[model samples]
Target: MTGRSDEYPAAPKAARRNRGFEAASRLLRERIRTAGESRGFAVSRLLTHWPEVVGEEIARMSRPVKVGYGRNGFGATLTLLVEGAAAPIVDMSREQIRAKVNACYGYNAISRVVLTQTAATGFEDGQAVFLHSPKPKPAPSPEVQAAARATAEGCADDTLRQALERLAENVLARSAARAAQKKG
Candidate 1:
């Protein structure tokens, strides 16, 4: 038939075009994966060995603050948030923190380190610095648990939350089945 003959030509061209696209896509994916690993390594090295680089600089400061990742036009920035109204809160400005972070990183990648004052109580309460020991225990509550899980999700911090979410779904399904049986 005429239809069969026409389909034959289009089929070969479609197969060839698909194959060409797949090859190009595979190459681009490989390149992106390699570049991601390189950039990830750079960020990890900076964070992992941060104390050695910034420990002295932080020590010199009277005000105690917590350091965490920040963001702006640049990819990942560092932030210094003051924790308390303690006497040692020497009122260092954002610019000072930025300068210190830049010097520590040995790169201008950090656009800035913004300073924010938090109303939370200070290290004077004898809570050890988080870097030095295990994190303090939080009181158990459903709201607290949900918030912790959601925060973990937003941070892209770990796989544990995903595992927990999966487990929670199973538990919920089991409970629903039990309720249905009871109603029946």
Candidate 2:
């Protein structure tokens, strides 16, 4: 045969019709493993399964930066990069997070969890998805605005009156839109 035969002794041409890919996620795992090794990330799928390990809420507020080991074979410390003003929130769930991480590794891999406050840019290289609130809709019509103003005319506190007016306007505009939609 023209081809070298050391590896496979030239598998019959028909025997190698096609070799399609394995799962894409499995393929990506090799890159992930290499990244973990190079970047000192926890090799226990912490970054991949973050949402499952921690609930969605906490996952958005925090992410595991790295697992730092103690000398003399002691337990390791998990540094979590928490975003913005959610430091207290992450601090409150420290033990719970440690327990969950240990369970994931099937061992006491983490002795303590450290919360490090970070900017949103902390996850710049990641594909993490966070829950976002829907944008508030603009008021639909001038009639709703007028009705809201009329209803708020007698209020003593200006701020309270303005808030109440806005609330009324939004509610009235929504109902009016729904009614028009039914007719149309």
Top candidate by TM-score: 2
Report backbone clashes per prediction: 0, 0
lDDT tens digits, residues 47-126, model 1?
43445545545533433233333443453444444555532443444455456556655766566454444533454464
Q: Mind giving the per-residue lDDT tens digits that candidate 2 earns over 21-92?
A: 778877788888887766555564788889899889889899888888878667888889887589998899
For model 1, the superposed segments whose C-alpha errors exceed 4 Å read 1-42, 57-77, 86-93, 116-184
Tell how far residue 3 is off in model 2, in angstroms.
20
Write down the RMSD of all candidates, one decimal each: 16.4, 16.6
Top of the candidates by lDDT: 2
Error of 1 at 123 (Å): 13
Which pairs in model 1 have colliding backbones?
A: none
TM-score of each: 0.28, 0.55
Query: Can you give the lDDT of residue 100 in candidate 1?
Result: 56
Could you tell me how far off, in angstroms, the CA of residue 73 lies in candidate 2 after the best superposition? 2.0
